[model samples]
Structures are given as C-alpha cells and as structure tokens.
Target: MTLLSALFRNQEEVMTFHSRVKLSAYDRDLGLFIVANRDDKPSIKPLRPYQMLVLTTKVKVSDTRKWVEEVFKYRGNTELLQQFMEWEIPKFPVSGHMLKENGVPGGKRIGLVLNKLKEHWADSDFTASSEDLLKQIPTVLSELDIPITR
Candidate 1:
C-alpha cells in the first residue's frame, strides 16, 4: 500500500496507468505498461505474473479494483484480467526450514536464498519441485556470493 501510494508522483485525484511521471513504473515493476500518443491512442499491456511475488508487492491490493477496471476498460478485453483474478501462484515448494536443514544460516540469508530459488521456480513456469529447487541451493548461494559454510 505504501509502495503504491508513494510510487505515483503525479498530482491527480486518482492514480492512473498513464506515465505522468518520467519513469514507467509498471514496465519496471510488473513487466506491464502503457504508452499513449498525442492522438489519445494508448497501448496498454495486460498484467502478467512474471514475478509472482511482484503482483502483491508492486500492485496495491486496495487499488486492484480500480487498476483492473482502468486497464481492462482500455483493452476492451476482460479475459486476461479474469484469468489473473482466478489464477493463484502455487506456494513455493521449498521452505526456509529445508534450507536450514541443508546448512543455510538463518536470518536475511535464508530469504535471499529462497528468493533466488523462487526466481528459478518462476523461470520454470512454476513447475519446479521442492527437490528441484533444493538442488539449486548451492548454485544460488554461489551466485549470490554468500560464503559456502555448507
């Protein structure tokens, strides 16, 4: 909520998808964005769960209704948003407990490792299993340059 509120820097009564600000926050955040020309022609891309975590992190829960309405209204197509409404990202198969048992130190490191694993999971289109993600722990940790106390 605070993220979204602080993001739209324009002084509008209601925050809109238009990039009134210099940066296109949606494209950076959700991989979805809109472009408008002087002719009032707008090209708006529908939302996608590129990073499953980003849906909640970037898009404000309270503004979901308004956000969906605005985007769909422009698109004149409701199917994608409908799918987004029904679709639920599966729970990550790997857990912090599993990481700990495998020698990952607790605290912020656990979250970093998990987030890296989740990136792999998302890359696999959310099909990676617990074992699959767990196998990548060492690689992910190395990529993150965390010391291998494991």
Candidate 2:
C-alpha cells in the first residue's frame, strides 16, 4: 500500500482533522502548528507528508465554516467557504518510499524523519530541493539510532 493508504487517508483515523488541527496556531516555541483537544489539552501527531495531505484536503470546507462563525476579530473579508481560496501550498519534495530507497528502514521512524524533513522544508519557505531533503536521511537515521550500512 502507498503512504496515502497505510498512513494518512484513513477517514476513521485522522479524524475530522480540522476539529483538532489548528492551522492558524503556529507555536513559535516548537515551530509547528499546534493541535488542541476539546478539553484544551495539547496533543500532536507527526506531520508526515501523508498526514499533511489528509489534513489539507479535508480541512477546507468545514474549517472554513468554523472560522466564519466562531473565531473573533478575523481580518479576512468573510469567513465563508463560498469565499474560500487557496494560496500556494508548497508540495513536499520527498516521501517515505524515497527514504526507503535511500536505505532508511520502514515503519514509524520513517514518519519521524519525514516529519523532521517536512519542517525543514517548510522552514526554508519550500525552497528545499528533494536532494537536499534526501541527504538528511542518513543523519536522521543516525539520530534515530538506526545504523547506516555501506
């Protein structure tokens, strides 16, 4: 199965990610989008490429409505989905299988490194190239204590 299948796109799994996903809430301390629960407790999932795909794709309609209705002092013209528009979202330049091909093993750790690289890519204003992202895998593997093979 692809990353979309095994990881992100499970409807029952990621939840209505919009309900928890605070796209507007970027934590300066962590440099990540913060996710808060109904009780106001913080929780986070690794923002793997697939999870991002799932989140972005699903977040549009309902969240637009919520922002339209609830959020206060909003600067936008209107908070309606009918007026929704998407600016450029940078496509992440790498994937789990790409990591595998580069000798990073499978499973949860793939997600961990992908999340790291995604952050790095986004932090670069999406200018980071695939080769730049891929080169980090070895270092990331080492950080995860996965021994690198020749």
Candidate 3:
C-alpha cells in the first residue's frame, strides 16, 4: 500500500509535515511556504508528493466552501479537523493555533479568524487590541532544533 494509505490506515502515527520558508507573492510578508509531509515519501521522479493541492483564498462575506473541499481532498487520510480541535489548536500558542490548526494565518483559518475579528470590530463595545491580533504568530520561528526569524 502507498504511504498515504498506510498512514491513513494507522491513525495513531505521529507524522511531521515539514516546510521551507521561501518567497512567494501570495502573502505580503513572511513569504509563502511549501509544506511537505514526511510520510508521503515522494520520489525523485516525475509526479512527486505534489500529487495533491489545497488552495484557500480569502473572502469577506461568507465562509469559503472551497477550503472545506480542498482540505479534505488531500487530507482525507488524516483526521485534520479532529487534530485541529485536539492537538494543533490546544497545544500550540494561541496565535499559532489559528494559523497552524485551521491552515490559516497562511490558509483558511486565517480567513476565518479575520472574518470573526471583522465582526467583533463591527461591534462598538467589543474592540480587540492590535497586540491581540498579532498574539499567535511568533516573531521567531523555531525549527530543526534551532531558532530562526519569522
């Protein structure tokens, strides 16, 4: 069976998805990132683990359904939503929770949070501080057992 299938079949495995911080026009700052789940075991030949793609674009009025479809397309093997609630969100720093858990800050979760923030901002009595918005994203990125600038 493929690694994807195996990983799926065994749900208890702890697999890490790695990404290199690179440049991209997709976001204004922090650059765009490419995430590689180590379990995929992509080969050097054509059609790499790049087999699947999930793209999340921001929208103002409503939740983007595309995020739901795309995430499931590539993430069916992993219980992504469950992990979001269980591990990713609760364990990470609050700011990182929304970003990493929901695939936001860089993916769909960012959009979702932004939408909520907008709603809260619209309320005259509920105003969040700027620091509140920047709370989760660490100014420094920790990886490879080292600290690097984010």
Q: How much lDDT does each candidate structure score?
A: 0.56, 0.48, 0.31
Worst 10 residues of 1 by lDDT: 30-39
Q: Model 1 over residues 104-147: C-alpha lDDT tens digits?
A: 88889998898788778877777989999888988988888886
Ranking by lDDT: 1, 2, 3
lDDT by residue (83-135, candidate 2, tens digit) is 23333345678987788888876787777778777766765657899999898
Q: Could you tell me the TM-score of candidate 3?
A: 0.20
Q: What root-mean-square deviation over C-alphas does model 3 reach? A: 16.4
Error of 1 at 150 (Å): 3.7
The lDDT of model 1 is 0.56
Of 1 and 3, which scores higher on TM-score? 1
Candidate 1 C-alpha error for residue 108, in Å: 0.4
RMSD of each: 8.7, 12.8, 16.4
Q: After superposition, how far is residue 97 of candidate 2 from its true place, in Å?
A: 1.5
Q: In model 3, where do residues sit more than 4 Å from their true spots?
A: 1-105, 125-127, 134-150
Backbone clash count for every predicted candidate, in the order shown:
0, 0, 2
Residue 114: error of model 3 in Å? 0.5
By TM-score, who's the top model here? Answer: 1
lDDT of 3 by residue, 1-150 (tens): 122322332222212211232323222111111122323444552111222121123332112222332333444534543432242111111354444543333544454455444333323222455445445234222211222223
Cα distance off (Å), candidate 2, residue 148: 3.2
